[model samples]
Target: MVLSYMEGFLLGLGAAVPLGPINILIMNESVKRYKNGVIIGLGAMSSDITYLFLIMFGLMIYVNQPEILNGLSLFGGVFLIYLAYTIYKNRDTKIDIPIQQVAKKSSMKLYLKGYILTSVNPYTVGFWFSVSGYIAGKELNPFITLFGMLSAILLWITLMPYLVHRSRHKISQRVSHWISLVSSIILFGFGIMMFINLFYN
Candidate 1:
């Protein structure tokens, strides 16, 4: 059981450590505003946990169907493109105001951004599906394995933002501009790739 948990932890850590959309958002937001960054991570993590639970318990089997996956992929592509534009448009944006100053409505918007983005990501959903299938044959306790994965994800989301937040200080508008620009490009590239795949697949 302990070995099973450790293996699951390693798997989760590997998956979460990659520089994907969620990590990218967390990094960019953390540099600008720590609270927002953490909130985004929390929201993303929440979505991840929900998916993990559902997938492991066989509630997400329908998601693997061809039509549904294509729909999700298309939506995810468009969503990423929109986010890229939004980020590029707001490249010079900064919300250095105190945490308390951030409006409740805006906070919820940020959280939703994180949640919806993760949710729509076909890659994330598919990856978890594969992982769950793999574990099913290995005789691992699904709950224990999921707990390990959850712990790994929780650790990443918390520590990652805090580190980025601590390191970035008095960041200039120029730096922010470049960061946003690069992030937008990466996101746009991913979105375009997804769109291209729609026709091929």
Candidate 2:
């Protein structure tokens, strides 16, 4: 049981550590407001937990169907392209908005942003599906495995915002612009690749 938990923890950590769209959003938010970044992370973590529950409980069996998978991939790809375009368009805009102005928006909005971003990501769905299937095949207790995975995800999300907050002083407008540009490019590339894969695979 301990080994099973450990394996799940490692898998969850590995998945969360990747510099995907969610991580990029968290970093961007962290530079702006540390609490907002943590809220985003919590939202992302919630999505992960939801996915794990669905996958582990056999509710995600339909995801294995090629047609359904392809549809999800298409939706995710389109969403990513839209997100990238929005980011690129705003890359040059100077954000002179006051912190007080930013504070007017509720934290729930930031949390929702994080939740929606992670929820729409087909890769995240696919990953959880695969991991759950693997765990099932190995005869591990699903509850224990999920607990481990959730623990790791929570830990990563908590630590990431704090670290980025600590380094917020080092980030400048130019640096932020570059980060946005690079992140948009990465997301665009992934979206394009996903579309391409639909034809090939």
List the candidates' TM-scores in order: 0.90, 0.83
User: Residue by residue across 34-101, what tens digits does model 2's lDDT show?
Assistant: 78788988998888878766775678776567887788678777877877887788775443455566
Q: How do the residues 10-32 of candidate 1 rate in per-residue lDDT, one tens digit apiece?
A: 87897788998878888888876
**Model 2 CA lDDT for position 116:** 72
Q: Scored by CA lDDT, what does every candidate get?
A: 0.82, 0.78
Best by TM-score: 1
Q: List the residue pairs that clash in candidate 2.
A: none
